[model samples]
Target: MRILLWHVHAAWTTAFLQGPHTYLVPVTAERGPYGRGRAQTYDWPASCVELTPAELAGADVDLVVLQRPEEWALAARWLRRIPGRDVPVVYVEHNTPRRDVPDSPHPMADRDDVTLVHVSHFNDLFWNAGGTRTVVIEHGICPPAAEYTGELDRVGVAINEPLRRWRVTGTDLLPRFCEVAGLDVFGIGAGRLRGLLPPGTGLYDDPPQHELHRQLARRRVYLHPMRWTSLGLSLLEAMMIGIPVVALATTEAVEAVPPQSGVLSTRVDTLVEAVRWLIKDPETATEVGSRGQAAVRARYGLDRFLAAWERLFKEVAPCMSTPSTAR
Candidate 1:
């Protein structure tokens, strides 16, 4: 299959591109948001190729995967073909609705043209998709080769644009965890948190995937402070790296973190206490983390993720033929 998609979510796209498909990512001279081509921070497969808008017009794209609403119009303009009408289309909703909480209607709600794919059941429940077809495909990742050392007693967190997302990302709640142990934050815009956080908190801005995984494993416990989000891939990555997690009992965190694997609670104090205990008790932390690693590996295996996508693709475009180059 030949899939047309933008380089929107690098981590998710990296996993998706691992399947037996030829992925077409748009690239511009400026390398803007919509045209990032292949991922530089994370490794993607060779099957993922970059093409300009003009080049794509001639490329026979078999399927279109939309991430944002604006991409609907962009697809029509760039390919000169309307999605759903001209080619099979799937919109992967990566974020939870920001407005009106549970009552907020999804931006793509009631749109019969495109099928909506949610990353978590929490997102599926909160979003009012109306009559639009919807399905939940939980996050999956290739487990990192690095094993957890937990030599550092610091807490590790990964979030993008934390200052701007603030409360939504649980950035404001970071200070509470900092008191328990030093923190090491890794992500885009993380460098800005240097002076703002306490003396112990260390900030690493947009480190490459290999470095990020290495740094995360050194921390005693992984902290997820997101108040609202479609389940974060970083959380899954941490678990896969054999790091015990402390996250709020909200959204998909409730489901992702299995029993005896990690601690989850609505109360910030409980989570703080859990981290404090986990930091002090390395033996218990290792045990818990191992359980998490086992559970996540079974639930979100790359094979399972790719198979689900394959089933969906077949349903959407049963008649579409596979290219010779596609796996």
Candidate 2:
């Protein structure tokens, strides 16, 4: 089936491209200021089209998949202009708590044509979108089998930015936690948040995805101190590579990481203690990492995710007119 996916988020793009179908992507003229530049774009084996807004308006598109709520207006316009009013529009929610926008209560939330797809089950439960048709589609990972057996001394933390003061990502909590744990933390963000890094922790400017994965594999433990939001793709990727995660017991992390895999706590002292415990006991950490890797492969692999999407698309797509129905 022909699908038009307009997802600015690179990870979403990567996931959709893995499916077997025609895909259309909208390219932006501007580069992303935060994070590494967009993931390299390549023509997929399936019929693929890359278009600008003007080109998209004139093209014969089928389904339009939007990744952000802010893009609803543009998507709505496209839907209206499409030849048949039966075209389905899907919204992929990548964030949690849904507080990025003021709680204005969008009218589109009540529309049957618009379907909301959350990246995590936690997000689907927490977000306030007023009775919209919602589905949970967790992020998928393509993990390498070759494990990193090198010396693993460092602890890694990956984020697009050093947590902003007002944002709920728990940036301020990291420095204090690092002070007590003495774990080396590295992250990606604008240099503007320089002083935000804990005293002796190392910081690497945003690196490419493969490079970042390599760097993460070198670290013995991955620390996810996010106070709010759904489980991040990076956290899942680390687990896929057999790295135990020390994260807060919030959102999807509670569901993603089992008790044997890692420690989950809400208190700062508990978080610090978990990091130290993992650091002191390498064997235990390794075992937990192994369990995590197995779990990720069984549940969050690309094949399972693609299958789920296929079922979803088949169910959601409008019924084509058969010869009998047309008559």
Candidate 3:
């Protein structure tokens, strides 16, 4: 099947494109948000091809997977075709509610033209996607090489634009966790809080996915303190990398992380204690991390994710082949 989607979430897109389909991503002369083409920093498959707006105008796309609200207008202008009207479409909502809970109106609300896909069930329950058909396809990871060493005693956390999204990303709480052990933070704008962060904090800019996983695997424990947002991909990656996780039981996280995997609680103190314990007992950390590794692989395998997506695609776009996951 030929699928057209904007290059928005690179990590999500990278895993999505691994499916057995031709993925056409828009590319401009000067790559920006709308047209990042292919990931330069991360390795992606050749099947995920880059096509200009002009080329896409004549391209045969079975379905247009829309991520952003503006992409609907952009698709119509670029493809000279209306999304969901002239072409089948699936709008994927990656984040949680922006304004208020159960009251925040989705941008594509009250639409029957396209199927709204929520990455997590928690997001589907919260967002009011009126009139639009909604489905839950929990996140899945294309496993990176098993690299968890637990050799480093520092705590690892990944966040983007930490200062700007301080509260949402739980950036202000970094100091609290710093007292447990040294911290190695990775993501966009992570280095901005060098002065404000505690002495144990070490910041790194956005690194490639492989490197991110490799570095994160070295940490004794992975910290996920996001207070408001959808389930982060980093947490899942850390689990897949066999890193013992210590996350706040918020949003979809409550459902995602089981007790046996690591330690998840609403109390930050409990989380800090768990991390300190993991640091002290590397063997116990590895045992707990192994449970998370097994659980994540069983639940969020690439094949399962792609199969679920294929089932959804078959529903909206009749031209697609039978989905093995579909009943």
Candidate 4:
């Protein structure tokens, strides 16, 4: 099947592209938000073909995958087709409620043509999708090689715009984690994390996805202190790479990380203690990290994600022969 989607969320889009469908991403010279095309920082496959908005106007898209609400209008204008009615549609709910908690109205609320897919169950519960058909397809990742060498006595964190997001990304909590061990932060605008860090904190800007994983796996522990937001792919990737995690007991983090995987709690002291322990006891950390690796491989595997997506596509769109890679 040929699917049309804007490259709104890189990590999620990267994982979604692992499925067996040809994905069409909009490309622009400026490489703006809705037109990020193929990821340069993260490796993506050839199936994720980047075409210009002009070219996409005539593309034979089987299904349309909508992430941002604005994409609905863009899709109609670019593809010359109404997303849900003319083309089968799936609106992926990436983030939890930001405004009214239980009362915030979803952009796709009460829509019958589009199926609303939530990344986590927590998002599904909190979001009021009105009468739109919704489904919870938990995040999945293609596990990187399990290289859990906790030689570096540091806690690694992955966040984007930490300085801008501040407490929301749990930037305030970094001081607490820094008390136990040296800290290394990686992600977009991470270099801007200057002055926000404690004495031992190190700010490293986002590297290529693979390099980031390699550096993060070397750390003794991974810290996920996000107070609000959807589940971070960083945490999942850390677990997939067999890094013991210390995350706040918020949102899906509580359920995603098993007890053996790592420590999940709201108590700052408790998580700080867990980070301290994981850094000191390399053997125990390795054991717990291995448990997390296994759990992620089983629960958040690529095959399962692809299957769920394929099922949804089959339900709404007819099976057409795969498109040729040639332009």
Cα RMSD (Å) between model 2 and the true structure?
Answer: 5.1
TM match of model 2 to true structure: 0.84
- Per-residue lDDT of 200-314 in model 1, one digit per residue for the tens? 6788999999899999999999999998888999999999999999999888889999889999999999999999999999999999999999999999998889878877888
Please name the candidate that would achieve the greatest lDDT relative to the true structure: 1
Tell me the whole-model lDDT of each prediction, alpha carbons only.
Answer: 0.91, 0.67, 0.89, 0.87
* Segments in model 3 whose C-alpha atoms lie over 4 Å from true places: 321-327
Q: How high is the lDDT of residue 164 in model 2?
A: 55
Error of 3 at 105 (Å): 1.5
Comparing candidate 3 with candidate 4, which one achieves the higher lDDT?
3
lDDT of 3: 0.89
Candidate 4 stretches greater than 4 Å from native: 319-327
Show where candidate 2 strays beyond 4 Å.
31-49, 76-86, 98-108, 144-146, 165-167, 180-190, 318-327
Error of 1 at 188 (Å): 0.3
Tens-digit lDDT track for model 4 on 1-327? Answer: 788988877888888888767899999999999888998887788889999999999999999988899999999999998887888888999898889998888999998988999999999989999999999899979777548798898899999999899878998888877878999999999888787677657888878888888899899999999999889988999999999999999998888898778889999999999999989999999999999988888899887887787667777785655433322
- lDDT of predicted model 2: 0.67
Give lDDT: candidate 4, residue 24.
Answer: 95
